[model samples]
Target: LTIKTKMLVYKACVLRRANLPSVTALLKQKRLRWLGHLSRLEDGRIPKDMLHGELSEGIRTIGRPKLRYKDTLKAFGIDPDQWETLAGDQNRWRQYLHQGIKVHDRNWLQRLQEKRVCGKQAAPESPNHDTYACNHGHGSCKSRIGLFSHMRHCKP
Candidate 1:
């Protein structure tokens, strides 16, 4: 994708994250130079909804059988039953998945919901201690709250 397209995609990603409405108009404003190309493509293009529906139907009817999650977990030397016993919460199970634990091959949101219900998973963990600790152990951090406090103090 061109830089302009990449930026548009990034904006769309941000909107999706925030559950906001389409910003295609904003994209058009920034990328008016590419309007010619967009007009040409739109002349005979397949509708996105139709394309998505076709792909979805194709996937739903794919041939050949697949192993279930239980089987997959067993093949990986993990016991779903035993894991369930120790899970104690759905959130923990989701965290286990997020932590790269081999499990019953379930979808993430389902696992997250399960973990949430069981109180097993806590809030997402920090990937490292770097966010909290400085290289020199000065006790100053660059986290969101820290930056807010810094701005408050530094503002005239």
Candidate 2:
């Protein structure tokens, strides 16, 4: 399907029906699994250190900080502070992860439905005519030929 296809439609009609996860869900699942593994690792391991490390002294840019992997855990309803404890038990972590994924997926689907409804209500109806409007603030035209002619010498 084209990029113009609505995500709610695509996920409901294709991904959910096919029992396939969206790329985002898959990535989050994998990241959480990897985090569980890292949490179980022995101390001082490079990957685990990187996951938990913070720079002691660095010049900060004057804006919001960049999002880290642990920050995303909140989206799955996992507290970043408690994730290590939760991931300590292999079987329990696996079960929790699955439940979290389900919760996240449900929330995501609900948000998409809300957005679709809101967008429909907010969007203005397009005029039914063979008119073309320039995206660069130029005037519109009644036909493709007129639009093309206007565009040839058009300036933003």
Candidate 3:
């Protein structure tokens, strides 16, 4: 089966179906999970410092800038600076992950709602309606918030 079909089967959206986690989000969760596993390891056994440490030895080429591991952590609402301490508490770390990862739709809804309230409308297919691009990229659609909502399920 195709990636889209698999994802649709795996995830369930609140208002609609097909809303799966983005690649970046899934990766962040995986890394956080690894951090949680690493926290349980004894010091010096698996290079604990290295796993929890930041390496800033080399210079990166200038441009749009690459996504760093630290960047993903920050994106997932984690503060890398004190991540060691935070991860020490397994329950706390798990709670944070659960809350952060589960709120993607809510976040998008908040963005779209705020836009509507401010009269900052998305380009609609009709004068009174909005068109969301297809998640499968087949074409555009006229489903009001589908434009904003399809973002989570859109395939690259």
Candidate 4:
């Protein structure tokens, strides 16, 4: 797509036509799959240990805390308290994962559509190029860009 292409437009047209999942969705799927794999691993395995490990030292610097893997799982619609139980059964976990992904994608698309609609509703009307003028009343402008440039320096 060209640099001038709107991201929302590109996502709706190109990605839908190509039947591709969004990069974020793919990453979420991979992470959840790995999490499920780790969940089923035998106890004392390094990966499993690390997945369940907690920091014992080093005080947090403060501001906002870093995001944890569990946060992503929650974002994927899994409850942190019950994720281990859910992941214990491979078949159930697989089904749950697919359903979660579908729900997440649908919600994401709905939000995007809402954003596009709200953006269109809130946008200012375009000025007529032939008679465009700065709000500060510098003079008439030949184009939208010229009007913006003039507005920058045309102080009231």
Candidate 5:
């Protein structure tokens, strides 16, 4: 069996063992795998996020809600113009993927919308201390802040 098929089966077994929703097993696996793959891409962006099983099974799953290609491309940091040919021609969609454009995280948008409507706590309020530090003694240091303020008088 192909890796995709194997992954689906494995996920099915896991979900069955866990007593979760086995009917949507394959769909959940596909979405998770897509996100995992995107996180590893060179561009640091997600791929074109499709409605779970849309293009995976093609015409057989035609009734699935397909995402807007333009929005998908934007989420992945790809210029929509770069996918102009694919955007305009349905026949070229698969070919356009050969050019290395990625889909967005399909579940992410849905979750964001749900959070908004349900008034749930959305994003984390805290920042990563290592990345956004004030440039000094570490851990959002006050020393760094004093240094930054003292540096304003120095000429380049």
Candidate 6:
């Protein structure tokens, strides 16, 4: 089993046991927890604010858009439109996670991990790149995860 760190660790994530709180639950809970924390702080400059549509002032590339934490949530059947406000009610957040856990599966785990990785960079450009290695923006990931299958399973 992995150390089970919360989201926003800026590092690769892992999930082992299938019969536990799904990785999706862990991540959603973490994000919602942080959302509540940030809302309590009442700071608009935080990065989380940008996620909540607080500010929109940048132009992004049109093609091959980078996957975001929001996209990862959508992959799990979550509509993050009200995610920021939803976090305020801890019980509601827990209820959402409880509902999410009921349906979380291996496909959700694999794709979420893939989105987390893709958030750091463009997809593998080098065909010769280590397909089985996790170039999870840490130069390398010690988890020894294979991105080839993720590559096949998840498309940008």
Best by TM-score: 2
- For 1-156, candidate 1 gives per-residue lDDT tens digits of 233544544443454466443333233222322322232343346542342233334454578676444443453344646644434444544444333322222233355467667886466876554555534445555585774565555524
Candidate achieving higher TM-score, 3 or 6:
3
lDDT of each: 0.42, 0.79, 0.66, 0.79, 0.44, 0.57
- Cα error, residue 92 of model 3, in Å, equals 2.6
Give the TM-score (vs. native) of candidate 3: 0.47
Quote model 4's TM-score: 0.64
Model 5, 61-156: lDDT tens digits are: 558676554454555444666544334443444333323222233344355467666775565665444543443433342355544664554344
The sequence of per-residue lDDT tens digits that candidate 2 reaches over residues 34-153 is 989999999999998997788999898999998666766876788888888999999988887777787778788889889878977956865544458866767788777778888888
lDDT string, candidate 3, 1-156, tens digits = 234544544222424444555554566788788877787788887557786676679877888897665765666677878877878889998887776565644555566577667786555555433245565676675675666676666677
| RMSD to the hidden true structure, all candidates | 22.8, 8.0, 15.1, 7.2, 19.7, 16.8
The TM-score values for the models, in the order shown, are 0.20, 0.66, 0.47, 0.64, 0.19, 0.39
Off by over 4 Å in 6: 1-18, 21-29, 43-45, 48-63, 106-156
Tens digits of lDDT, candidate 4, 81-119: 898899899998888877777767777788899987897
- Provide the lowest-lDDT 10-residue window in model 5: 97-106
lDDT digits (tens) for residues 1-156 of candidate 6: 445545444222333433466555577657655655665555677564665674348787789988675765565456768765766777876676567554455456567678877897776665544434544443322233445555445534
Estimate candidate 4's alpha-carbon lDDT, on a 0 to 1 scale.
Answer: 0.79
Model 1 residue pairs with clashes = 89-118, 89-120, 90-114, 90-115, 91-115, 91-116, 91-121, 92-120, 92-121
The 10-residue segment with the lowest total lDDT in model 2? 1-10
Candidate number with the higher lDDT (2 or 5): 2
Q: Which ten residues in a row have the lowest lDDT in candidate 4?
A: 1-10
* Runs with alpha carbons beyond 4 Å of true place in candidate 3: 1-20, 52-57, 108-156
**lDDT assessment of candidate 5:** 0.44
